[model samples]
Target: MHAALNAAQRTLVREIATLGTESGVGLYIVGGFVRDLLLGGAVREVDLVVEGDAIGFTQTVFSRLGGRVTPHRRFGTAKWRLPRELATACGWTVLDFVMARSESYARPAALPVVKRAAIRDDLLRRDFTINTLAICLDAERAGVTLDFCGGAADLQQRLINVLHPRSFEDDPTRMLRAVRFAERLGCELAPATLQLIEPARAHVAALSGDRLRHELQLVFEEKHSANVLTRLNGFSLLAAIHPALANTADAWLADKLIAAEAAGAAAEVCWLLWLYRLPAAESRLVAQRLRLPVRLTAALQQAQQLGAQRNLGRKLASSEIVSVLAGVQDWALAALVIAAQDEQVRTNLQRYRNDLRYIKPLVTGHVLRARGLAAGPQYAKVLARLRDAWLDGEIHDAAGELALLDRLLLQR
Candidate 1:
């Protein structure tokens, strides 16, 4: 276990143990950090649970570590953003401290009501067995493994077992997380846990849009995100969130997601591609249902509009092609490229991506003004003509641009 940690992590663990000893509080490294450490996966984030004041513990740690500490009073959680120098030296940034607490759901799919509790109770309240594992960081018991729920056994068996049958009922988001974790870790859901998923599908809609969107974003972040989507589709969980997803878009989502990642596009681009075939109103509905950020919704709308142009045929002039794709983001354009089934559309998109998208006019507004062109609508017209000429390969240099500009002015 000690060999799993690098020098920095071991140092941080010792520091935390010392602090726990001084404060007379039980401290342990819990959840993903311990699970990943046991799995020999890269442990990037540190999740600490404390039997005493989490916020006060983090403040004291920050005083010695020289990091900025942010506290959430409501949840008794605090996060420390390691100082730049330390982060540079250690290759870690943030550390989270949470009060060891038990949680209960008031109703199906509602947020958990938390209360301070013992480490055993806290571990029992977690979503999955593997995540319930922890390592004690007290001075006397430092490095001791706590596996009350048989988390290490489940981890060894490569299974995802919910701590309780109502785990998904309490948080339907856990269903999505189960798919994510299964796909991410190459594990399977325990049979009992898998049996509960279908019944829990009914409670999915009770979740907030923000929570749904957040889990979906994590899905996209996975390397085999398509597998997660396929798993969701199989369980009818995607339909539970929004029928449109299953009815209209699920067929192509997995394929487009794979292609989008292959093309090095952002997750939002994959989302836009997923919903690209929906009509304007349905697109708006999906955006609202997911509570998508304004920028992404606008990009989706723009991609849909650009896709509707239908004028990007092979015979179109370079200037017309450039005009069609002028302001579209690379990721959005990549979405369009993947979504386009027509050979002509794909060809045109490649043209814009490879050649015409980078075409810029050599003559700027300042240069045009210096050349006695007034700053008015004609300035735009003249510049557009120059840019068109440039895109068409008719102008190659400043002199060529000037010559084209002179010709346009003469024609005008």
Candidate 2:
């Protein structure tokens, strides 16, 4: 298992082990890093737990390796970002360091109060059994695997099992994580763990909007995001985050997702499609509840409007099509095209995407101004006319554009 790590990861492990030996501090690679390592998956991030001062240990490692270390004194945690060139070479970005700590939630759906504890206690405090596995980086036990919570057995059984019954009550976000991990790892939620999902659903609302948004983003990041959404809906958890999705049907979303995947659409574009059927007011309400950024909300609004007008694209002239889709993003347009039902709408959208959208008159605003055409509201009208002529295939070259301009000037 130790040999599975890449050269960069192995180097990091050796250096941490040496630091532990010199400083007499216990160190181990823990959490997701260990789990992914055991699964023979790519390790893009490293999580480390130190039995002694985590910040001091991080500083020592940084001093030796020449990197920036950011410490959070209050949390007994620190993060080290490798220098850019080295990080590029290593295929990893950051290393997280935390003191071995146990947490106790003050109340249901509240943040935990943390305190330094033994490695065993730390392992027990984790969300899922699979994530509790750890690998020691200290010299004497350099490659020892620690599984105080039957994580290895659970991993072999392909089950996601919580460490305790009250786990979700303490941090409801774990419910979302359970679904994410179950879908991501192609595992099933243990029956006992599945039983708590309903009770945990009620507390998901207590989580802050930012945290909920983050979890939702993680779901969208997955390749099977549509399936994850279906699972969340089945768990009666989707509405707790926002009512818009709860009231709507997900069949169209599933179909659109398949098309979007084939089209190579981005996650944000897929999310916009999911919300495209809602009215602007309802979309705004959902966005506000989820704390979505202003730009994303606006994009959703535009996509909704465009998606509603998809049928009109086929009947409209080329210039009209350009006017309608002038500033819309390609992803948004592609998503709308996928959702469009009419073949002509699809054909027109394809045309716009491939050719018409890029058509513009060879004439420039500078040339128009040089012709003594005042730069004002009328300039836009004239330019629009010129561009429309080009898109309509009526103007083929600069001479044709100049002739059109002369006619417009004569008419003026």
| Maximum-lDDT candidate | 1
Minimum summed lDDT over a 10-residue window in model 1 is located at: 245-254
lDDT of 2 by residue, 297-387 (tens): 7778777787777455567789888888888877667777887888777777788899988887777889889999988898889988999
Q: What is the lDDT of candidate 1?
A: 0.86
**lDDT (10s digit) by residue, model 1, range 245-337:** 774435577678888889888888878877888889978987898999988888898888878876775567889888888888776778888
What TM-score does structure 1 among the candidates reach? Answer: 0.93
Cα RMSD to native, each candidate?
2.2, 2.6
Report the backbone clash tally of model 1. 0
Instruction: Give all TM-scores, in the order shown.
Output: 0.93, 0.90
Give the C-alpha miss distance for residue 6 in model 1, angstroms.
Answer: 2.6
Q: lDDT for each of the candidates?
A: 0.86, 0.84
After best superposition, candidate 2 residue 350: deviation in angstroms? 3.1
